[model samples]
Target: MEWLETRELRYFTAVAEELHFGRAAERLGMAQPPLSRAVQRLERRLGVALLDRGRHGVALTPAGAVLLDEARATLDAAAAAARRTRRAVEPGGRLVLAVKANGAHDLLRALLDAYAREPDAAEVEVVLCGIGEDERMLRDGRADAALLHPLYSSLAGFDSEEVLTEEQVVVLPAGHPLAARTSLTLAEVADVPGLPAARWPLRDGGYPPGPGPEVRDLSQLAQLIALGRTSTVIPASARAWLWTAHSAVPLVDAPSVTTHIAWPPQSRSRPLAALVRTAVGLGRQA
Candidate 1:
């Protein structure tokens, strides 16, 4: 049996992740041909083919799929070990915080305070991930911790904490009579034709990069209702996140949106308690 080194696993993982040799090479800041050769070498060492080359791109083989997970784990453990070593030397290692949606910036700020207050003076790195990206980052160990929506909990190996409960809102056309109602109710709009539930593109990225704008001004969402055809229901936090003029009407007694804090089930915490406390506080203030 051949002994495997960390470097090969790292390279292989990136290639598996990108699924395109060129893209993976670019991500690693290396040239494509060598990256391809390295992957070839790894397959030779392992005595198995890991990828299925393709005209469009590449796909993982059955062995490649198994290897991808193992490769990711190997890289994660190595990274974790390096971080621990640095912290042992300097008593401070950078933490990566992955959050769903940018509005969680307040929580990030609180988390920073908590980390800074730690005796080790740990460094915090915050990543504002799209709605579904948090769990992947945590399990892969790319991020030290994450604040994700509870709905995304099925991501395999992560545990979640219910950190915040938020209210809902009714978004109406700017000129709709309901917009003048001061307060809105879902029951009232249930029969009033179209309510914008948003077909949600089968993929929820939270906010897409270089947005065409999700709500594109609540007034427009209201206008969707104003089409006198459809009404929109959004979380009250949408007020915090997408407030634009008198475009959305707040509702009462609606189901609260739950925000979750997530991490790998077996993950450790540097200043976990403080981080949780600060997260709760940020939610309260919202």
Candidate 2:
């Protein structure tokens, strides 16, 4: 078998994603016949049937499902390579760091300050992302690095350095009965009557099954907690974002959340390395 070229990979990816040659070709700005031929040739070369064409439209075989993931990764890698190459030639290219707007505020500030003092450190641009958007930003080359919490974010394909590890806490309304407690067990906090656990949206834009109010950000969660509509477990450091109406109690049995400076494995930028080193040193001092 011959090595697959980028063009063929792109064509196959479009078809695999759309599962219809006509739609895929339209999206790719090409005619349908050539797109169909290109896919057929790729299958022939790989000696595998990637898709099943039927009257009901098209479906991916097991092999197609596997290849779709691989092809997307390959395209992301190629795009990153192009972006990095261009940035390398440009003078004073800034490093973009993605982070949740309401998380790790102290750690983020210290990391930036320390990195700024380093010799030849690059200017950092902070990209404040929503919950669960950090990994996608890193994978697609939108960011040079990210401050991520492993408990709430996926770290599947990145190289990361642990920055801070802390216990969890439950945030509740100050007027709630549980506010008087200095500390609470996970079971106690989770079973509070009339206070359901706040539901957060998953990466796929769907909320987990729950009766509580759906929250998209820390501000929303804090509001719901203040109104006595729901309660939530979060990293202990997130207490900084709570308002006066909110009270936090350490959850004794809750899992620890580790904050990490994560980046794609394929990133070879020097500025990103300097920032990661600075973050690790700060973590050590904490």
Candidate 3:
């Protein structure tokens, strides 16, 4: 086994993530040749071929795939160490909380208000992230904690407290035939002519193949539903944002969404603990 340097791990991670030396080089603000050389050096030091290069372009070898995950963990730890050190030296530092901008509306409002009243609470800076971004934000030190729903967000690698749980609902245009229904089953909402359920982007940035419109955020989906172009199933709390032109029917068979206050397991920050405590207390009340 050989000792790996942070620089080499960083270089390898960039290439592996982009799967293109040119793009990775541009992202790292360096020349492509040097970036390629760095990756080659890392592979040689590890005594394994990392990337498979051919006419089709770069693909990670089995070793490269393993190294990618390990390298990301290394980089995230380094970033977290730096961030914590800075926060420790600074006075009156604020704790950042990440959440999907459209999700966790009610829970976030209550958590913020309650946390504000805590005598030991530090300033809470909310970071409105895109779907599936909260985990990265929490792991990489960009956020101290996140409000995430387990159904729609990955809660792996973090310690969490369940903050809210609610039934799911099918959101539809007000004039839709099923809008008058008191409750709906998954089968009942699966296929609707001209109102296909909106497809959300997967973690990989691509939408699943479907006839439905691809949507990136809640507002976009809401607009599409308003226009009678799409429908979607979401947590019941989202009903708070529906317009008069929109309607929601309880999805009796849909899985409940449990919103949790999640943070990196390695975190030992006092402000973060206070915020989590506040969220847990409020969750119990709910």
**Top of the candidates by TM-score:** 2
Q: Per-residue lDDT tens digits of candidate 1, residues 226-271?
A: 4544555655554544434336777775666677766555545555
lDDT of 3 by residue, 187-278 (tens): 99998878899998887679898999999887898899999999999888877789898999999999989889998887778888899999
The residue-by-residue lDDT of candidate 2 on 24-132, one tens digit each, is 9999999999999999998998999999999999999999999999898899888877766676666786888999877877888888899999876898889888878
TM-score of each: 0.55, 0.94, 0.86
Candidate 3 wrong stretches, greater than 4 Å: 14-45, 49-61, 88-90
The C-alpha stretches of model 1 lying farther than 4 A from their native spots are: 1-4, 10-60, 69-98, 101-130, 133-143, 152-155, 180-233, 242-244, 247-256, 264-270, 277-286
lDDT to native, each model: 0.64, 0.87, 0.87
What lDDT score is found at residue 53 in candidate 1? 92
RMSD values for the candidates in order, in angstroms, are: 6.6, 1.7, 3.1
lDDT for 220 (candidate 3): 91
Clashes of 3: 0
Question: If candidate 3 were superposed on the true structure by all CA atoms, what would the RMSD be?
Answer: 3.1
Between prediction 1 and prediction 2, the one with superior TM-score is: 2
lDDT of 1: 0.64
Candidate 2: residue pairs that collide: none
